[model samples]
Target: MKEYSVVPNKDVTGWMVKIEDVAPEKLYDERDAAIAEAEEIAQKNKPSRVIIMDQNHEVEEERTY
Candidate 1:
């Protein structure tokens, strides 16, 4: 199954949507927007999962489609 994660940037200034097997990465200015984008992709690729990480890089939440 495919997977995606929304993680905080190293500087903690932004959020990143990390999609498995997809490079370059997707950055977002807002946390909500990043999560929304991740959800969109998760919905598109059903049977996948979306992981949300906290600023400390720990898993905060997860959702499966």
Candidate 2:
């Protein structure tokens, strides 16, 4: 199964959603938006799970698609 993570963007003032096999992380203005984006990516890659990280980059939640 693939994995996607919604984490904070250290280089900017927002969140990011990155997939395991994909380069160039997607940036988002909101954490919830980032999670939503992760969900979308996970949906596209069906057998994947989305991980939500806190501000400190700690895994806070996970959803399997």
State which candidate has the highest TM-score.
Answer: 1
Task: Show the lowest summed lDDT stretch of 10 residues, model 2.
Answer: 17-26
Model 2 residue 61 CA deviation in Å: 0.3
RMSD of 1: 1.5
- Model 2: per-residue lDDT, tens digit, 1-65? 99998888786589888878365487889988888878987899889998888988788998999
lDDT of each: 0.89, 0.84
Error of 2 at 22 (Å): 6.8
What CA RMSD would candidate 2 show? 1.9
- TM-score per candidate, in order? 0.91, 0.85
Q: Which lDDT tens digits does candidate 1 get at residues 1-65?
A: 88999998889899999988365278888999999999999999899999999999899999999
Clashing residue pairs found in predicted model 1: none
